[model samples]
Target: MSSAVISISNQKGGTGKTTLTMNLAAGLARRGRTLVVDADPQGSALQWAGLSSDEKPFPVSVIAVADNLGREVGRFAEDYQYVLIDCPPTLETEVTRAAMRIADTVLIPTLPSPVDLWASLRLANAIEEVKLRNPRLAAYILVNQLEPRSALSQGMKQALEEFDIPALNSHLRRRAIYRNAALEGLSVYCMGKRGEPAAAEIDAIIEEVL
Candidate 1:
């Protein structure tokens, strides 16, 4: 398959950008060769993979590159079936824009809160600009940290409707296994039966977006 570049971007910190990037990379790696580009200056992706032991390393290859990130990602795309770029949490930076321009699709993880929705507006503006140049760029919102038994607040749902980009039907819920897998430098897929539900959530995301 020709390389498909997916960029995960968010303007707000603590939006689980790195977590989604890493787990998504793991899912994609299972399907084909996948590379996770740690374009975020924080280097979270790299650090996550670094935690892996040599005996059982991270499932997908990961590397950090801030300089000429778009160009470097293009190079990697030629080799891997999927190249997932983990952009910085802030959208104003050129680094984030660079990744957005080159991506085939962009997934923005958002919390189910009014504050987070406001934060996403700025990102929506950035995406509008990026889409101008790259018309094919498809963007979606993947609701993160969604409470399992809680219903979506009507106000928040109304706010979500204000955005032009549609939110994915699949969402990542608040679960302990996600953190558990991370502590071991592993994706939920490796957590055995304990990871099944979380892994299933990731798999649903894969079905919708990947």
Candidate 2:
């Protein structure tokens, strides 16, 4: 079967891009075989996966590709049902551009800050450019680390409407469990009750986006 390539990308750092990529892959693995492409030069996804014990390793496989990202992802796509690419933090890099070009859906993870929303405009423009070549590419904004009661969080979707790319209806709240899971090299799904809510957030996102 052909894999659904989803790129977790953003122009700015601190957007929890890699964190979302790992957890999203965990959720997707429940449905079928999943793979994560660690396209970020920082190799954060590799570190996260490395933290897992053999007894309870991170579900699915993760590989790092230094160059020819699209070609590498395409080769692996034939082997998995889902491939999530954890792109480099900056939009200026070819790694980010390559991921967008090959992605069936580009999930641009962003914060609720005004600065992040503005930065997304740059990525939005980049998406349009990629679309010129990849006409079927679809994109969305994923508002992360949300505070449900905060003014900015409540108005996130409305704020995203200003950009060409739409925001996902489901969002992830600021939960210690996400970081906690990271410390242990596990997805929220592997954390038992502590991870349930966060896992639900991931499930909601995958459900809505897919």
What C-alpha lDDT, on a 0 to 100 scale, does residue 93 get in candidate 2?
72
What are the clashing pairs of model 1? none
TM-score per model over all chains: 0.95, 0.97
lDDT of 1 by residue, 1-210 (tens): 568999999989988898899998998898999999998888888988988888879999898887888778877766899999988888667987888899999999998887887888888898899899999899999888888566664455677778778989888888898898788898988889998888888889999985
Question: For this target, which candidate reaches the highest lDDT against the unseen true structure?
Answer: 2
Error of 2 at 111 (Å): 0.6
Ten residues in sequence with the least summed lDDT for candidate 1: 148-157
Clash count, one per candidate: 0, 0
Candidate 2 lDDT over residue span 57-175, tens digit each: 99968899989987888787778999999988887679888988998999988998777888778888889999999988989899899998988886776777777788888888999
lDDT scores for all predictions?
A: 0.86, 0.90
Q: Which stretches of candidate 1 lie over 4 Å from their true place?
A: 151-155
RMSD of 1: 1.4
